[model samples]
Target: MNVVILSRQQAVERVGYSLGLDGSGLNGELSPALVGQALRRATSILAPCARYELERSVRQTLQPLGSPGDVVGPMVQDVLESLIVYRDLLEMRSTADEVWASAEVTIRPAAPSFVKREDGSIAVLGTAGDVITPIPEDLPARLVHRGALRLLVPTSAEPLAPRLQEFGLVELSEKAWLRLPRVEPAGNYVEEWHRRLREAPIGNRPEGLLICKPTRRGTLYRDRWNPAEVGETGLFVARRPQRFGANLWCLVDLQPNSTARIVDLFSTGDTLRSCDVAWQIQMALDARAGLAQAFRCRPNGDRSTIDFFSPIPSWAERRLFLVGRRQAGTGCLYSYEMATTAADGERRFLRESLWLVEQN
Candidate 1:
């Protein structure tokens, strides 16, 4: 019983696209539109390396050819090829979700769910049941790289090994589970999160999510003439034993209908002044967005909101910034909204918010 779902039109569209027939219309051997969404996500994860390659190529092309538009075409085409597999991959996820909801299956979050520390004690979590009675010394490598030892996805109630083999170990399964190194939230941070949740006003719990120590800071500004430092902006949270704080920023290029938004919230002993985090937000608001201009936010004491001239439409380019320190477990966030044009002429909306979570 192979319960896979697919649209013939999508396949035809993708095939045509994969063959470099971008403007050949949808009546081809493949359907790009049908597969475009999944392709984008899968290619994003699997061929993320391609992005670096494309960027490198662009840099080279720009210097010799000096035409940004000319270089963009080839780079975008390369990205499209790398992402075509996303269509099937997304279908798989969708199928798995439906199957899990309706079937008699108990999926464990972690598989081979036990590991032995140096003390020779076992650690197990999830329903897989002390999978490794005697922990192996090489267990950490497997845990980090191998992902769940088993999965009962709906398409097949079988464990994941065979599927992993088919998908290509390094490309599909391994990269999907590679965890970005991040700082562990401190005990004080955990307590503060609890306090915030506990003191939530009847219906006013924090509406967005917060990630602590997301990544090291990075900037997109490559020109020396550009005043912004490449590593000086981003989104991140700083957490301490009993407190947590957020510093959000947006670098230069603020224009209309940008897809990115910035919000900074933190719990600190020292009171926050507008001067501390406002400049970062100001940068985001000033980014470029084709013809549309971004909404500006003015900080009034402790709170502020951005009222845009109009919402950024879908499929717009957006840049986001997040910076954090693992040792200190603190950071900031930045976002940018890209300008988009609708095929049918519609409005754009690019809005993002932030929130926090506590560890159990």
Candidate 2:
């Protein structure tokens, strides 16, 4: 995989060139040197430009280079030399701007398909064969505190956010939780709770997305999300030739900086159950990956991009330099725990949404 990775100097030059500082493009209204420096320091992480890795990757994969008369040899060589530059231009997260409080709902996916619509919108093809179109426009921002339980692979589904308030999905004033029913017996307390929820007319509303639906699809999760890739949260970046067959997805910390003051290690702690272990392990990883996506990656126009942290807006971005004043890695981990107690107080389930939203 040829991912464009560049050096500090190279990235600085690229932005400056774009802004017309290096005598390229039209001179911009902003200062090129200052803006270039800002972008370099802006919030991103890129891999080191090691000659050995590049040499090995290119030599082994460039089959045409071995040909007697390869016409595209020089072009390929040029690309190899500038791998770092193109990758440095990729912007990872789009919710760096701000945070908004919205109803946090989690639906168990039997099989979910994320299909890219022709209008640059993404639709969720739910396991039930129902299409949930154009996922909420501001979902990433709303998911600042609540992270996803698991990442769902792209199936051909759809989106459009539901106004939970109108549908009674927002049960509490603080932050409500929504999870579709699974295994619980019908008359059981939790099952009854979910049954009542499933009976809600949430999905029928104009603002409804996959927030509610009563249809029970085929196999538990057949043709839905890829079970094999379930729980595997890893992202690798590289410049593919657009012919890479299928897409490889990874999670991103959509956490914003504003939530940090309220939820540090000291805040979300108690004697019984404190911050989750998984969230603790993920803080550093989120910082690392978010920064990497910020500074090192490529954006090919208005493509469908999913927020791995939350299965909401597969965003569309030409360039994402969060309109903010903070440096990279200041984002904090925020978790909202929602618990449901059975009527008899015998059975209960608690789900947590953990995220790292970038701050301004």
Candidate 3:
């Protein structure tokens, strides 16, 4: 039997038809313009590397089913081709480019049920009332990455523990996990976090021992460099003791529904803007607080939240914590809960756990 191989274009088109993209429109044929538009959007969202990844995923999924023109070729082609379309949609909706870059996109014919990792990786959590088998290690990098992070696998998949361990991933029963590095403390420093909490007008300070403090404050959105016109404000802080870790806090005014910078940040899918905000805050903090040494900061996790739709008050606050420190071969972990309340009585809570370590 002579096996018929599929060209890359044919494979992509077959996948598109499987995804119902071919005749979903008024015309019986899928528009080339539509495919081009989707491709352009996917490229914008995933960068040029997306094509490489998508092609790889398609080949991997279809290789086991047989040749393109075999008895099961059409069935396999549909499955593989739909994945390509699904990848484009997922990329379009995703907010973080780094997460999408690291993710191995997959789709099952069945319903969706999965556990999401702190770093944004996901694994099947098993379907209700059914024992689910573990996915093969053929796509291990997509499903798991190197790190001492927690996992959320189902009981039925417990048999795959050895393989998961070999891959450097583990499942934890604890509800919270931290992945921060550690660093040596500077030793000489004022207890600014303690004092500020005592003096803050936020009523009675919560009783977990003040471990962090804001080192500086500035406006997140400003026009014409006028401090008086600054409606949005941000704060910066380094994790206590070790001067290596830092955090950023921003309070944006959402008044008159026009001055809301928080809305602007959430709409553009440019969440990296938070990193820029954090860096600016860190620089300001170092200059104002006169720290012994300035520790370099970078984003550690894919955890972030935005709530601007509910009947918000005149302003909203956003915070980013960056920790990179390690000490004596042990990683340092920090946990905190941030609570923000709007003037109109809307409240939101953010729980954070990060590991601190030095940058290599």
Candidate 4:
């Protein structure tokens, strides 16, 4: 239940941030004192991926869950019961206006359900084994990540599997994603995105170079990035601070339904005209986050979306879940990302999916 996605240009979503997208201090309104200062600044930008989220919650419970302060004392009591279960689902969705009050919807800001979908699918598995299906679907379901998120789901995303058999969650593999095709750019590309945001410039990077740590020296993901390519196997990178020049990026372990994937990229040099002006200033910031064009995939499946509320049916259709790995002759890491979710529809936001280190 480590859900941190609060965009709409009042940003907040970082683990290893720097794929260009910044400005957040919560002033976009929605008080509770800015939702307790945006949940204490998203729990301090997810405390450097807390031991890479406790080693992906200990390989989804493959046993031996002790020490390390006894599994961080129940992962800090399931992150305070996932903030009291999203503050009682935002007080029962603001008094059960229980279905976004009747229609023509347009409220946006829906994640209130202890948002957890590190990869989606796996909707419940109790019987003392616990994984109460996708983080607190309500009713005492304490969780963190176990039950092999059912080997990366994709039985059309239902993944039940759980008949109890001591430390289970074995399914090996099965996760194929698709749906990518959206192109509409060329309308003077907004005057070349205001002349490259008026000629971008700022990030400094070069303080002894090795700023890509996290290899507790074991092997398979010690806390990520010891050379994490292959579309960052379930990513988690955080290095976004220097005037974020060139839209610096790296902050996405986010996946709450409108799924996604596209890891690492900050380009400014590495040839190919710095990767075509860093992918034309990220499609001019994905055309001001409404998205229109950006598709160049090869890694399981390609996808893109803005999905203008597909004739609502309780809304939920905007995807871009990618996964890469094509080393061969090297030179292959151009990226893209865009998000927008709906449970009550009317453009719930999530833009700033990044990747582009200009390595041609």
Q: Candidate order by lDDT, highest to lowest? A: 3, 4, 1, 2
- Candidate 4: deviation at residue 103, Å? 37
TM-score between candidate 3 and the true structure: 0.22
Looking at candidate 1, what is the lDDT of residue 80? 39
Query: TM-score, each model?
Result: 0.21, 0.15, 0.22, 0.22
Stronger candidate by TM-score (1 vs 4)? 4
Provide the lDDT at 357 for model 1: 15
lDDT of 2: 0.23
Model 2: per-residue lDDT, tens digit, 1-360? 899976444554465444223423313222322232222222121112222333334334333223345433343333332221112112122232323211111011122323222232322222222212112333422211001011112224422323322322222211111111233221242233233334433211111111111112211211223322222222211111112221222112111331111111111211111112212223323333342111111123432111222111101110111110111121211111111111111111111122233211
Q: Which runs in model 4 stand beyond 4 Å of their true positions?
A: 1-183, 190-192, 195-318, 322-331, 334-360
lDDT of 4 by residue, 259-326 (tens): 33323342222211222333333334334444433222222223222221101111011122112111
Which is the leading candidate under TM-score? 4
For candidate 3, the clash count comes to: 20
Compared with the true structure, all predictions reach lDDT values of 0.26, 0.23, 0.28, 0.27
| lDDT per residue as tens, model 1, 1-360 | 887554545554554344223424545332223232222323333332233343344334323322323443444443333221111111111124453232111111222232222222222222212222112333322222101111122222333343333433322232232111122323333344334434433321122322222211132212101222233333222211212222222112211332222332321321222222232222222221111123333334433322233222111211110110001111212222211221111121222211111111
Sort the predicted structures by TM-score, highest score first: 4, 3, 1, 2
Misplaced by over 4 Å in model 3 are 1-10, 13-159, 167-360
Q: By the TM-score metric, which is better: model 1 or model 3?
A: 3
